[model samples]
Target: MTADENWWNGSVTYQIYPRSFQDDTGNGYGDLKGIIRRLDHVAGLGVDAIWVSPFFTSPMADMGYDVADHRGVDPSFGTMADFEALVTRAHALGLKVIIDQVLSHSSDTHPFFLESRSSRQNSKADWYVWADAKPEGSPPNNWQSIFGGPAWTWDVRRRQYYYHQFLKEQPDLNFHNPEVQDWALDTLRFWLDKGVDGFRLDAVNHYVHDAGLRDNPPDFRDKTEPDYKTYEMQYPVHSKNQPENLAFMERVRALTDSYPARTLIGEIGESHYPVERLQEYTAPGRLHQAYHTALMHKPYGAAFFCKQIEAMFRDAYAGCPNWAFSSHDVPRHVSRWSDHAVTQDDFAKMTAALLLSLRGSICLYQGEELGLGQSALSYDQLVDPEGKTFWPDNPGRDGCRTPMPWEAQAPNAGFSSAADTWLPVLPPEAARAVDTQGDAESVLTFYKQMIGLRQDQPALRAGDLVFLDMSEPVLGFVRGGEILCLFNLGLTEAVIDTANVGDTLLSRFADVQDEQITLGGNGFLIARRLSE
Candidate 1:
């Protein structure tokens, strides 16, 4: 609120996946005007900032992740004026605005890629990652795409194969070229000059790849769990997470540091050493914060979380962490971990408290406050190529990318007035619409309470965490040597002796009495020590 240099520390960031947030144009898709109209809802949540996912000009391959124009907004998402209006309104409500910056790759349809692939002798010929085919006409290497199939796609125009970590429609940029780095930095400068607050760097680790064409090593881990693509079979040692990524990050940081209060939070996807990569990428002279997918992909439980968090902080990275349980790429946390939760609503509230109590910046995906479970979509309803590719085996991300339900009884659940939405809204999500639970004791209200508590308690926000020795199903930790946080991440109720505990600060389905506390299934509590 004070515009401090470290304003992001312990801040609550709300992510709005533009396509599903709101549809103001009656065109069955969300736009910037719709986001401006909904800014009040985000501000009401007591969030410190809002991180809007990619709304840039794209071919819609991999959704907006395949950017066609770095500085232009997609016609489907409104014009630049509309974006500026949204930023103005958000700042008026004392909320910082962060937009997604996808620098790792661009749509193959982009002019740069088009020019690069023209004849291999053009000015932009080296702008993209192109390589000669093997003697047998196979790909340059054995790299695989994250969506599926080979990472390399043969181009007849240039008579060469280009590398793409995702879909073939997306061509990886050759960051080894200095001009490309400068071009990307200029794109960030364009947004910063527009008075934007910060950027969430998409797939930051994928910005650079092994300079030498090399095959990745196989991951010999158990394959009992369902993996959507063969990409997971390999460790991606040569395909991405290259050592040169740190130098590029330093360049990005240098540009961002030129602006006051402008921050950079990088998204580190599934890497061999995500935690270590995050730490290195966010260290001094690099990214201000790095978001790792470890927590998002981890098994749900106290032990798993404790181990992950301990490992992350043990190394002590200079840059802070930006944590989130749900985002556009993954399934909703409530539904993902439903096997361990007694009820979806209870689990949602419990997770909200747990996330805010953690020692780092937090991100809340839109519709999460309403306890929206993943929408069950049929094969035909799926738009995500990844979802269609893995059908029954993986289900892809379409389930979590559905529209947000505003009015339960309204047409299309108030997301749009059109006959159909991009993705179907399930009955469960409609039943938990915003209007239906505004005045009730719902997950939305619980989020507001938890967020307010975090804003008021410094210990809960930027405190040092010390795990407490508690029995199974009861995970306890002390923050800043004062705030004691406890959770029962199981189906059965659990009780813990609270001899050192003091006055209750915030709680959900939990009570303390006679130096003891009883937590219901999927319950949580935050207490402050009297001695402190």
Candidate 2:
């Protein structure tokens, strides 16, 4: 692979949710300056890139995902100067900086939305997705928002119901409008010129909507499950994942390609046709990568992993698929996959090893390396509005957004000097703090070793992945070249035939050569071919 292709092919990216990373100003919220202060810490993890969540000016309805300004930094996240400094610092450490770009919609406070809603004939009126209500005075259609209500919000000013795939305060942009397309593309240029390496495009699949204003069909599945029948649960067939979205993705791709060593990775949310859409969205000259959370919500087991990986390769992502086990929105992998049989730390460490051995690029959520289990947040202490709205039944993401534990003994776990942090700092997490795990044999050390191993073995990073035929509870795959990985998800030790195996390179437990190797429950092994 050329240097440019090498940039993303097998690279490990560290995702930093700025609000929970660190708070330098003591305002109880993390800022860019805090990120700059911790650049050395991130670089120490040996990751190739850093993906920061949005810090743009927003109404905070959905945090920074609902942007009001495309070019300016939010006061809560520090100034634009602070952002530039962060880019400079990260680049100096040989780390690529990828910022979150929410192109699907903007805060209602955005100037485009303000002017577009002012008059139906205004120059910017068509820049947003707007449509007249139904003859019966209902919404344009039955589109539902992800935040638990109708996707269409009635705007009396324009005498129409505009589309909002998320919170009503976040109005969807009209990518169908050519000028609007130009504006969003220009926003990419603005950042690349400012030294950003790439973008994590937020809700990229929802860029285009059904032009005919079609009503969504009802889903017959149970509506009481946590993520089942919420507002976003209604039929999203016409509201999102439209085929027309590809042309605009191509336009965005062309813009990113104009820059050297830059990339675009989209966030696609769809259960049906997700992998298919991934293939189309990234089919060569469109997006460099795209990710869906299908596997994140499933139970951790050999069968689940097999199906997800196979589908990805068999479908659209057969050519290129970035692998991520966890991110900001979903439950942390450790807690989500914890079997009462194993200690939380064991699950966490094993998960890190498993994610690193995947075929495509890897994204590591913050604090995952420390074997950090999810924090338990009480209803009153939750900060995420989503968690608040669905309380008890569907507790939001605040459990995963707790402050990063930096010290096992320090007050507030060394995350903040304030008497109380924005999110609760759990005592269990504090015990596994970075300071405590900096020791040579700590779980954090294991991550460093595994990540370094991936970096040293070019074959592990970008080579083709071939799944090995195995029995239940055993998942196996040979990364192109010489590396073969075997994972045992069973509760009892099982011996595997490695008659063709050569030398052991790394193992979570026991080691073996050409002989039969016994894998402990939840254990894994990695070996290189003899010729290598």
Candidate 3:
């Protein structure tokens, strides 16, 4: 494939949560100007692209995920000129820019939603997923928000209930309307015309609903749960992951194809059948890549890894998978899987190696290379609506969204000049700050070497994956029949046959003895095969 067609394949894309990455405005929040100043740091990591989270005009209800304007930047994140500068600087550093597109829903404050909800026969009455209440007037159906409670919220003006998959403030758009689809496509086209390399399409599966307003069936797997109180109590067959979504995917691909070399990555938000959904989205002529949380959970093992990988790659044309161990929404992998490792750093390094070695593209979250753990916050310090609403049971996403630490000795760890930040910069993250760990065999250094190594070896990059016969702790695989990759996720040292293992290209906490390879806790090895 030509560079234009295959440049995104197996590439490393760094994810930047713009709000917490760096603060240049001294307003206690990072903005596009900060990112412009930090472009060199991202390019230095040997990554191909940067996936910036939303910085659009918003009410901050669900952070920038609740976008009030699709085509404008929020003043807090700086003006359109700042965003243009950011894209220019990133491109100048050889880094492609991928901005987030929250097309599934819009902030209730958005003009579109405002006009739609004003009256029954407005110009855009069906612009949003608004429906009449049931005869009893409780809700339209038993559909529940992913966060919690009923997905439908009553609007007094329209005298109809609007569907919200997240916060009540984020109302779902009615993609069933062709005009809505055209509007969404225009949003994508605007950014593309402005030279954005790609988009991280948020909640891609939630674009359309069943339209029949059918109640979702109960999730009988866990019997004790009450219906409509939680998202997990029922299977979301009607609410999301609908069959019509595939048609929209093709439309998105059609638009993306119009702009050569621009890629579309869909975030499959459904709980059930995510892998299958990912496969469908990534099939020929669909998204360039699609990813779900198949590996981001708390579980740690070869068994889990094998299951997710096998299922994801079962179809030859399932398309490319974009793997990530941690993100702004999930707990830091190092912290989530810390108990299984002999040391925190070891686990972090292992995950870095594992993620880059997978047979698809990679998304490295900001601060992942620094071995940052999830920050623990007091209830009073919580800013996330989900964290505040769910409290002890589910702490929500605030911990992972904390500011990135740059200098250990600088005020606020050089994250901001303000007296305090939107989220406090904790000691653990500060200790592993970029300035503190200066090339002394650290996780940051390891990530650089590993990424470089992947670039040096073609098999490690665009090669097909073939899993080996291994059990439990030892997850072994070969790339393009030349690279032998082995990872021991458990504390117990496990041995794997090393007959075809040639030169030890890169290894950590591993021992090689003739025909046997012993991997220590969170150990890994990447090697090339002997000349045939």
Candidate 4:
């Protein structure tokens, strides 16, 4: 790929939720040294880049998402020297390193927030989003958090309500404040200077809020949504996806422009504005790629995939969008879509192949290739505060945060030598251990081969998506006007009416033929366009 060309296209991004990836010191949590030790395993997966979740200094309230020190590593993860070694090792293994940047907020223990909350006259008083309580003391507005309940929290010292879109301990950063923006940008440069390749901007759109502090409008449409955020029935018009955030994104773009071949990807989430904001964030001088929750859920079927990819292509946003069937925030795809027509193993392999064949880039959450299902955690075993609050209604994301299984027989799945791990690894996942799945016919092996195909095939890499409309359960598209992709999301057999296109290049099951293509249940077809 050219220097200016986007490297993220068709690239496989491996997401390592550091806390659960591996534990080096047996401290009951995975750390930086553990990641460094496993760099070879990651590189062996044929992924183009590795995206490490936050390891920034924090109180562990939100598992390091609440940053106390932006430039330093948490003692639990490792020291700065260990981080440097990780970057060096990852790069040496031909893997790009992208760290998570939690620019949206910081822990209450953060110096800026501590000073900001002390009094209104402090040097950093405006560093966080703070507002006086209403006369009725109900709250600034009806902004419920994803974790549940009101997004605003009371502060006894300041006697004012402060904003936190997430956990109250994670106070929202005042991106509206010029100093705050400058400080965040400087922090970005600090890691860039450390030889980091890129950043996965956490809740990037949530950085800025409505200066007016107006209440979010009601939305009774999605009242059936299991969570409080959706049940509050409010459209977060002024609260998130603020018009002002785009200009700041341009500033971030300018800062990253100085670094050669570096990338910036934002995690765009807003109930009202999704794909449109994705386009705005990545249009030219903003983010290199923007990911949404479009293909991140739902069954691995034809209609859902077709509608999503086709919509992106029709909107012309497919060029810079990133797709993942599963991530840390959601249940594993194997478990989520296991209800569809196939076994868990088939669901996992099919999703992996489909993700690699998509027009845009892809992110592979850790252990996804092994067909790891969501870990079953009882209410008592749930360590995630988010999960605890929602209880049985909204189980939160604890299921996907379980430790990775490396061994089939070792206790704790060999994730840690420690007597216990942060989260238990289930027996089924243990059976799909890396050691057992390293062989040629294993699911892991298939992922390796498919990822290699994506990297090596130009048509799959920088391809323009061409929609091939078909009946339900059959999703079809052309990559680079050369590679034809078809997916059967339903149970029964499906046909690829290749009357216009010719012969199958690849098939999930069955052999290639000269003319039409027939696929069995949960089958897929890939073909090279005939010379025209």
TM-score of each: 0.98, 0.95, 0.97, 0.96
Model 2 lDDT tens row, 1-532: 2247449777888999998888888877888999999888889889999999999998788878889999999998899999999999998898999999998899999998999999998889898888888799998777877777778888989899888888888999988888888898999999999999899998889899888878888754564545643554566778887778998898888888888888787888777666787777878778888765666784777778888888777833545566787788888888877762266766666677788998888899899888877788889888677787777876888888888888778777877777767787888888889999877778899898899889988888888788888887788888885788888776677788766676677786655645677887777888876552
lDDT of candidates 1 onward, in order: 0.88, 0.82, 0.89, 0.82
State the weakest 10-residue window (summed lDDT) of model 2.
223-232
Per-residue lDDT, model 3, residue 513, is: 83
Whichever of 3 and 4 has more TM-score, that candidate is 3
Top of the candidates by TM-score: 1
Query: Who is ahead in TM-score, 2 or 3?
Result: 3
Tell me how many clashing residue pairs each candidate has.
0, 1, 0, 2
Regarding lDDT, does 1 or 4 come out ahead? 1
Q: lDDT of candidate 3 vs native?
A: 0.89
lDDT of 1 by residue, 1-532 (tens): 5479889987889999999999999989988999998889999999999999999999898889999999999999999999989988999999999999999899999999989998979899999999999999999998999889999999999999999998999999999999999999999999999988899998888889998988899986777876657898898888878888888888888899899988889988865677788888888898888785777864877888888788778755445888899989888998889898788888898888888888878999999999888899999999999888988977889899999999999988999998988888888899999998777578899899999999989898888889988878888898988999999998888988877777788887787887888999988889877782
- Cα lDDT of model 4 by residue, 1-532, tens digit: 2234466656789999999988989877899998998888889988889999999899988878889999999998999999999999988898889999999999999988889999989999898888888898878777877666788999999999999988999999888899999998999999999999899999999999999998888764554434455425677777788888999999998999898889888999854656677778888888988876787665455666776666665654534777887888998887887777477766677777788887777889999988899888888788888788877876878899999888889877878888878888878778888889967778898888788778778888777877777887777778888888877776777766565556655567644455667777677777677776
Give me the overall lDDT of model 1: 0.88
**How far off is residue 479 in model 4, in Å?**
0.9
User: Which regions in candidate 2 have their CA more than 4 angstroms from the true location?
Assistant: 1-5, 220-233, 315-318, 511-514
